[model samples]
Target: MLYLSSFTFPNDDMEFDFFMKIKRTCYDSFYPFKVLSRHGFERIDFEPVTILYGGNGSGKSTALNVIAERTKINRDSIYNKSNFYSDYVDMCEMHLKVDIPENSRIITSDDVFDYMLNIRNLNEGIDQKREKLFEEYLDAKYSSFQMNSIADYELLKKVNATKSKTQSRFVRNQLMGNVREYSNGESAFRYFTENIGENGLYILDEPENSLSPMRQMELMKFIEDSARFFGCQFIISTHSPFLLAMRGAKLYDLDENPVEVKRWTELKNVRTYYEFFKRYEDEF
Candidate 1:
């Protein structure tokens, strides 16, 4: 299930040596170069389900994107890479247990948000079309003009059809149904289900953004099932305790200086949640 067994990033010394060779000061940053090396995150030994846990600006995302780039996985959203981005990726290495599936992809929050936005936009367009169809139905149903010749056959059919059907039914016949209306959370979850197929590697970046606690738990179960029952592998960056607690998931705490692997319950974020909920146990 582990397509990618391990990956190595350029260390501080490598970044320093690379930067020392660069004489140009026009670029403001060497981004991915210094990002992971800052926390001494030199490598990742992946599992069937591996999670990178960290707060904002903790380089978890950087690591995922780097692996995605190095492994040539599919990505929907365009990530901004600095001038040194290629050089940084070149310095990194990936050890694959097997050839990465062609369907393997990196799913970012932007990808999910964009998918939801597209659905909303499509529904808006369909709604506008439905309004126009309503006006057309009324016009055709009440039109007094007689059919002059064969040229008016299509119009005649429309008039007869509109008159025979109710407004809602006529509009339904004229236009496709609204993209099966779903809330933002539902849309985000759907995006995941639609993209993730069997026996492929999927890198998900902060998938809990639009999901409720209930939905996060649902996703946790879904991911667990995919990894266990299906021949799938996952590399996720997240802070959600629900996702972090997935069965057999190896968690690397990016918050740690040396980026140590630890149990999900031991993560600072999970501990904070536990303490907060424990304090309110009596109220529940």
Candidate 2:
């Protein structure tokens, strides 16, 4: 279950030494270096499920991207890479327990958004084709076939087929079915359920973004089952308490200096949710 046993980023001292040696203004900026150098976030050890918990700009996503790039895993959307991206990754180090499977991948929020967008576009195209099919059906059903040419042969076949069926049925047969069965949440969840294979490492970025509370819980169970039943490993960067609270998940508090590991209930976000709900407990 553990594909990546441990990985380490260069300490600030090392990065600072490298930074001082290089031309300060040569690249203008080394973004992740500045952010990730706040503390010596040394080694990150993985379990069946390793989670990076943080607020926005906490360097969790950056860390995931670095690991994904280092291992050359399959990824859906491109991540933000600066001129110094490789320089930063080079400074970091990783140790894998076993070979990273080719099916191992990183899934970002952009990938999920694009997946949803593509579905919408496909349905729009199908709708347009449906309108064209309506006209084609009418034409074929009422065509006065004067069979004198080869092109007419195709038309005659169409006319015969169209006349045999009702207009709606003919149009339905001609056009593709709309891809609207899944809602945004359902489709987003499907992206993970379908793309992720057994016995592979998966990295999810903000997977709870479009999911409701119930769907988030469903994803949590799915991830847990994937790791427990199948030989799958997951390293996720997320802000949702629902995902953060996954049972047996090893969580690193990226918001903390040096990135300390903590229990999910101890996270500020989970505490915030707890307090809010407790305040209105009687109403619930």
Q: For every model shown, what is its TM-score relative to the native structure?
A: 0.93, 0.91
What's the lDDT of the predicted structure labeled candidate 2? 0.87
* Candidate 1 wrongly placed segments (more than 4 Å): 146-157
User: What lDDT is obtained when candidate 1 is compared to the true structure?
Assistant: 0.93
lDDT of each: 0.93, 0.87
Number of backbone clashes in candidate 1 = 0
188-261 per-residue lDDT for model 2 (tens digits): 89988998889999988888988999999999999999999998999999888889989999999988987899
Per-residue error for 29 in candidate 2, Å, reads 3.0
Q: What is the lDDT of residue 94 in candidate 2?
A: 83
Best-fitting candidate, scored by lDDT: 1
Q: Write the per-residue lDDT of candidate 1 for residues 219-261, one digit (tens) a residue.
A: 9999999999898999999999999999999999999998999
How far residue 168's Cα lies from its native spot in candidate 1, in Å, is 3.4
True-vs-predicted CA distance for residue 66, candidate 2, Å: 0.7
Model 1 earns a TM-score of 0.93
